[model samples]
Target chain A: MSPQRSEQLLLIPLRLAAMSAAVICFLIVALLVLESLPALNNIGWRLLSDANWRPTPAAADGAFRVTPMVVATLVITAGAVLLAAPLGLASALFCRFYASPSVAVVYRRLVELLAGIPGVIYGFWGLVVLVPLLGAWRPPGASLLAASLVLALMILPTVALISESAMRAVPQRYVRAAAALGLSRWGTIRSVILPSARRGILTAVILATGRAIGETLAVVMVVGNIVRFPSGLMEPVRALTGNIALEMGYASGDHRSALFFSGLVLTGLVMVLVLFANRLGHRGAISDA
Target chain B: MLDRVLTQPRAKCRKVTLPDRLAALLVWTVATLVAGMLLWIVLDLLRHGLPHLSIGFLLDAPRDAGRAGGIAPVLVATAMILIVSLAVAVPLGLATALLLSEYIRRGSRFAGFVRHALEVLAGVPSIVFGLFGNALFVRYFGMGYSVAAGGLTLACMVLPLFVRASEEALRSVPDDFRRAADALGLTRAAAIRSVLLPAALPGILVALVLSTGRALAEAAALLFTSGYVLRVPESLGDSGRTLAVHIYELAMNVPGGESQAYATGVVLLGALLLINLLTALLGRRYGAQVQGVRR
Candidate 1:
């Protein structure tokens, strides 16, 4: 066969394979949307507006309020991001500026290792260890607090890794300029480096947010999985993800469709975050250039 | 470092400010605390789980809803899921990586579209993948809750990660290789096959190892697609349970299942440690090869 022909032949398979990801992504969205349409048509805006969640066989009879779960999901995500952002930034700063090179390398590897540990394991660990610890303070060990704490730990490495890279991407000259101006180490980091890397850091936090929001098993295991508006940190709350995972097996008819609706909401939220993060990341790159 | 160098002459004249010292101390403390927590988790699991984790535990099938037996069936199911996921993901991922790096122009809109799709796919929750798989592979395709369905779900979940890693691997192969191949009048296909792929093999292997670790650890994506059946799966068509799902079930649902759960956790932790070790080894080897090229 001619060389050009062979190359052309290879491209055929390669291009087809390349299309799979896009196709798969489209298919997932399509299926979710299609499956969710029933819930939307039946429940209408009440799905988003109501706070009641009583899944039943009859579509009209069930209250099917996703608001509480969505709120819980956000609450957990917010708490996790709040807890993780500072710690992750601190770890990033330590790795980037404070630690010696060898220490930084090992520290980085360790953090990456943490990241590699599965979400399920984190949840398992939380259920085994953290739940009881929190239960000591509160009546029920499983609460939004436990979920947030485990999720914070689970996502800390992501935030740290991304933030460290963002800081590293700051121009060397910027650091030199800060030094030349007699700015203290902290002053430079706070005033110049942090400001310059703010967009990247925001992107990191946003990505972490997406990860935390999408997280299912970990949140399910740790969060109390009670469907309600949690009044306090110790109160058990069910996240959108927890709602799906815990009930999907038994859920049928309208309940199953409602779960898919929740999935759709969760997917929509995550996609928005992903898009936002990508925008910030790309803008940061362009501005750096 | 530059701060130290620049401030050395005035170090004696100007005292380091309180915030500077405090910030440094804070980061160090946070780093220490984080590391300490990681240590605590490992130690606690080992202490509680190590006693029950034996070859017998690994090889025995569960007798009573996972409270009394070993994870032999779970292990087999895990391996099957891993096999199917890797089988599907590796080739598609590699081809996509090749398409990204070798075939397409760098700034092409289509390439950007593919990458965006991957990024979105990567960010999609594993549970959503479970739903998608349940709907598509299980119900629509009528595979039911089987290992094949679960593995196929995992394949979709891991594809983005594998592609990103492999693309980086392919891109790291020096352009000089292409030039050399061109000088020898090698076809594009031949150059990619014999020159590029070999050079990128180590990185691609590392990617494969990492993806395998991820696939093995996944439970959310598997729960619906791979139904929780404890029996040793006779074929891919049989419903099976994975170690993660087993641990979750034992920890959450089964009464008096804590010991078994701990034991199962130990297996997962052991797998994690092995993966980390493999990654470090391959990384060092890849580093050495890259340095060789640089020199």
Candidate 2:
């Protein structure tokens, strides 16, 4: 066969493959919308606005609002990010500037190991170890605190690795110039590196936040799965993810559609996050150029 | 000015500033604490799981709602699910990646859209994927709850990750190889198949290993689509539990199933560690080869 003909032939399959991603994205949105239509039409915006979620037929109240769960999700995610940011940034700075080459390599490998650990294992560990420890201090160990702590550990690697890369991407000449200016190492890092790497670090934190929001099994296992809003760190609270996973097994009809609606909301939230990250990434690229 | 600046700080530079010292101490403490946490998790799992983790435990089937017995069936289901997901994801991912790196221009709208789609897909939670899978595979397609549905759902979840990694791998192949292929009158397909794929093989393998690790660790995505039936899956149509799901169920629902859950957690962690080691080895090999070429 002619080379051009072969190339044309290959393009058919390649283009089809390339189209798969867009097609899948369209299909997932369409399916979620279609499946959740029943509930959306019935419950309308009340599903999102009200703070109740008693969807089971057995319950005296059949309201299916997710405001409280959404709040719980945000709370745990915020807590995780708050806890992870400092630790992760510090670790990233350590790996990039503080640690010797060998130690950095070993340290990075260990963090990567932490990154690779399955969410369920973290959930398992949190449930068995951390929850009980917290429970010792405050009764009912499986609270927002336990869940946030687990999630913080779960996302720490992402934050640290991304921040390290961001810091690494900063030009060496800038550091040299800061040294030429007689700035101390930390001063240089603070004034030169952090400012240049700020966008990247923010992107890392945003991505970690997105991950914490989407994580289900890990948070589900630890976050006491109570439907009410958490009054404190020690109180049990159910997140959007936990609600769906814990109830999806037995949910039917509107309840099931409501669950799908929850998924839709979760997907929408992450989409915004991904777009934000993409914007930062593109702006950073343009600025660098 | 340069001489003055250098001379002025020459003595001062010898003594680290307080903030520098404090930053060093903070980073060191945090790194140590993080390392210690990892160590504690691994040690705790081993301590709890080692007694229950035996050849028999791996081979036996749960006799009582996972409160008793083992995870042999779960292991089979996990392997089968992984096989199905890889079967779907690898070809699709490789084709999509090739299209991106070789066929499509970098700044084109289509490329951008595809990338954006993938990023969105990657950021979507596994639980949402589970719902998507449950809706499309389990309900729409009439596949019901089966390994095939679960695997296909996992394929959707991992496809973005796999494609992105594979594209990076393909892009890492130096442009010289393409030029050389053209100089030798090699067809595009021939050059890609023989030259590019071979060069990028290690990197692609690393991607595969990493994607596999993610899929293996998933439970939420598989829960609704795969449907947790504990019996050994006789076919792709059979519903079966994965190890992660088994761990989740045993630990959360099944009272007195703590030891079993610990053992399962260990197995899952061990599998992840094994995959990470594979990735490191493959990464080193790829790094060496690329460096050799550069040199």
Candidate 3:
């Protein structure tokens, strides 16, 4: 073959792979929607509005209510993000402004390592340490609060790293401008630096929220999967993810379909958060330019 | 950094401000907390996990439903799954990345669409992948909960990460290098192979490392598709359990295997830490992506 022909052939495979990359979401969406068809048809909006979860393969009356799971998912996400966002933003500010350059570099690398460590390990640590530690206060220790704390730790690195990057993108001239205006150090950070980096920081929070929503194993390890609407931070709650994971192995019939439906709901919820996050991230970038 | 302080002569003169000191203290405290969290987990893992993690624990198969003996079969299963996933993801990821970065125009609508797709892929949760894997590979394709099914599902999960990071890596290579190659009368294929690939090699390697970390640490996607049978896998079709799956089962299935779960957790943590350290070293050596840790 001619060199050009060989090049064309090489291009074919790469193009195919790229096409695959482009259509992966289509495949996933199709699969989730198709498999979830039965559950969606049967459960309808009850999955959204109902709070009860009963799985009886025999009675065929087992309702896979999604309310508690959805509520728990939101609650866990809120609790974790509530703790993570502020601390993460603060740490980002600290690393960006207060730390010397060498120290900042090391801090960033440590955050990377923290990010690279997987969710299962976080879950494991939560199971062994956090749960028992919380047991002192809450007895079972595997409460919504413990899961929230673990998730807070799990997502802190993401929020901090993204926040740091965003804060770093603030032009030095602005800080200098604030200094010229006789603004104090904290004043400059709060007034000049944060306002400039606001879009990026919000994007980080959105991304971190998505991370918390999608997180499964770590949340499962700590949160007692009791399938009840959480009454308080110390109460046990089952998230949408925990429900799918718990029953996916041996669940059959409508029970199985219900699990898949929960997966669908989760997919929908996470995709929304992700889309919002992407929008904010793009806005942040555009504003930066 | 000091230059900024030095340049601000007025601020530098009265450097001992309360707010500055407070910000310094708070920042240091947060940094220390972050650092301390990492240290405490590892130290606690070592304390609880070391005694049970013997050579027998690694080489021997489980004797009593994971209550006693080693995790050799889990090791084999994890190895098989990782190999299958790596095989599928690495080639597809690099090719797609190359196509996006080199073959496509930078500002084209098609490129934007592809980027959007990869971003969507990244955001899709692993448990959702679990459901999709069960539907596509397990039921529809009739793979029947085999390692093949799990591995393929995981491949789908991490392929976007591979592509996104690798594209960033490829794009980071200066256009001057491609121009240099073009001046030498090389064809597009040859230039990409000889010049582009070399320049992007480190970034590509780093991408591989990140994807590998995701694959190895994954549990949710594998939970349904892989089928948690802690037996040594004989082939790709055999139902197998990874260390993550084993730990999940042992840790959650009540009180019998708690210590063993902790030991396995240590092993899992070690495996992950090793990959992370390798990624750090690669980033340090390659002079790329020290700042770019993808989600």
Find the candidate with the highest DockQ and give its number.
Answer: 1
Alpha-carbon local distance difference test for all models: 0.87, 0.87, 0.82
Which tens-of-lDDT digit does each residue in A236-282 have in candidate 1? 99999888889888888877888898899899999999898888863
- List of clashing residue pairs for candidate 3: none
Model 3 CA deviation exceeding 4 Å by range: A1-6, A48-51, A282-289, B2-22, B288-295
Residues B118-144, model 1: lDDT tens digits: 888888988999999999999999999
lDDT of 2 by residue, B74-146 (tens): 9999999999999999999999999999998999998888877777777788999999998999988999999
Better of 2 and 3 by lDDT: 2
- Per-prediction DockQ scores? 0.61, 0.57, 0.58
Residue runs of model 2 more than 4 Å from their true location after superposition = A48-51, A57-61, A282-289, B1-15
TM-score of chain A of each: 0.94, 0.94, 0.92
Clashes of each: 0, 0, 0
Clashing pairs in 2: none
Worst 10 residues of 3 chain A by lDDT: A280-289
Q: Pick out the ten consecutive residues of candidate 2 chain A with the lowest summed lDDT.
A: A280-289
In angstroms, give how far residue B173 of model 3 lies from its true place.
Answer: 3.1
